[model samples]
Target: MKVLRNLIAIGLVFLVILSSGCSIKSTNENVPSSSNLTVKMLDVGQGDAFLIKTSQQVILLDTGDIDARDLLVNKLKAEGITKIDKLIITHPHADHLGGAMGVLMNFDVKSVYDNGQITTTSTYRKYIKKVTDSKIPYKQLLAGEHLEFGDGIKFIVYSPTKRMIDTEEDLNNNSIVGKLKYGDFSILFTGDSESAIEKELLNKYKDELKSTILKSPHHGSKTSSNNAYLKAISPECVLISVGAGNDYKHPHETTLNKYKKLNFKIYRTDFDGTVTITSDGHGYNVLKEKVQ
Candidate 1:
């Protein structure tokens, strides 16, 4: 009888140990990942461009207008970047993809990502040739796909789903909308998506739309950043890339007022030059170029 009791006690102890091990594993899986991601909104005058740097990777989003190539190259050189891990052309608009060819020619690119929409412009063809010559892997990101670059740094492509891609709508509507998450911080990047797309996103991912930082769509044009969409994002800071005296009058007064009403600190590339957001897993800081 004593031997039987001892055996039963040993089995109970083993079960307890196994349960404890599973609990620890589950806790580890739930812990948030850490990554140091720096997003730089390069001042390309009347165009849009951004650089994303994580601990192990560097990604360039768009390349701004054609003439901004030199400036973009200089910025990358200053940052000690000789290679680009990924290059994401949000759309085929000249203002967004014009200088991308220059980047492909100058840097070692691991992969290229775009919406895959074709355009007849010479600049677009030149970029395509560069991609072909480089022979780097290319992918057209779809909604719900997640990309992780070590250390828990993750990016979720939230727009331009396959259904939308097949319909052949406006290129702007096909813009790639991505959300970057590092630890507890989140930022949303909207590539010139207009009201229609914004409404779609708002309805689809209302809760997930919350972000700490927002890159104002369409350079803060009135056509984008609808009031309801802004409310849904509820960003603490808004970044706008626009030229000082551009023909389109970007960063329009009304849009500026909207952000002001929402109590969002506004950062403009036209006035502040390069805008950098640095985060260390918990919080982020925005650094702007010296205003002269």
Candidate 2:
């Protein structure tokens, strides 16, 4: 009888191991195939945060605000991001760079890129310290510089061709503008750039500014999306990052109407929560967070 009991116990152990193996296999099947590219626009409330994923690398655009630090870290973990190949801080505004210190402290970042703009804010100071302490390679992104993350994926800087010395203009005008091209699809990321900068970009890049998607400048501020810039880029879709009931009333009504008249599809963080766009180089699909 004792021998029979031992045999039954061994059979139970073997079954448990097989069940666990099946569970792990099922989980792995749900992850997207490595051949795809993903861009996630996080909803960080009044701030900006973006994650770009290629088969072999990960890139982070702004880090949102300090208040969203925990959320940002959790999101990265959820996406299985163990390391950041490149981190780009578009400008020095708190909303754009505040959470950067947390990200730098928590992840292994290989490199960082910025527009060389500075601000006296405490958040900005700490962010700089974090980057320096990590001993990561840092570069002042320049216009015409190309970033190659993997085969067929290219990111090109298009603004801040030269340092701005004017003390009168708002810092928003100094924001870095970049474009990402993956085969036939392209996206333009205009930091918090205003009208004056937009006019300059339109004058310089002209048709080169065209993209399939545009992260709307200045969170859809009326002063940023002038007709000339819109016509120059002629994006098929526009994304605006803003907080619900924000004090600035972001994504101004007039600006939203302008996009509507242009017949471009518009997505907003405030309304959509988080937006994820997946691309296969030639085509893409947009996914919105489901309301709870």
Candidate 2 wrongly placed segments (more than 4 Å): 1-35, 165-169
Tens-digit lDDT string for candidate 1 (1-292): 9999999999999999986654211101122243378888998888888999988999898999888888888888888989999899989898899789778878889998888777788988988888887788988887888777556888889988888788866888898998888877888999988899999999999999999889999999888989999999998889999988999998889999999999998888888888878777677777767443
Please, what is the TM-score per model? 0.86, 0.85
- RMSD of model 2, in Å? 7.7
The window of 10 residues in a row where model 2 has the poorest summed lDDT is: 23-32
Best by TM-score: 1
User: How well does candidate 2 match the true structure in TM-score terms?
Assistant: 0.85
| Candidate 1 lDDT trough over 10 residues, lowest sum | 23-32
Candidate 2, number of clashes: 0
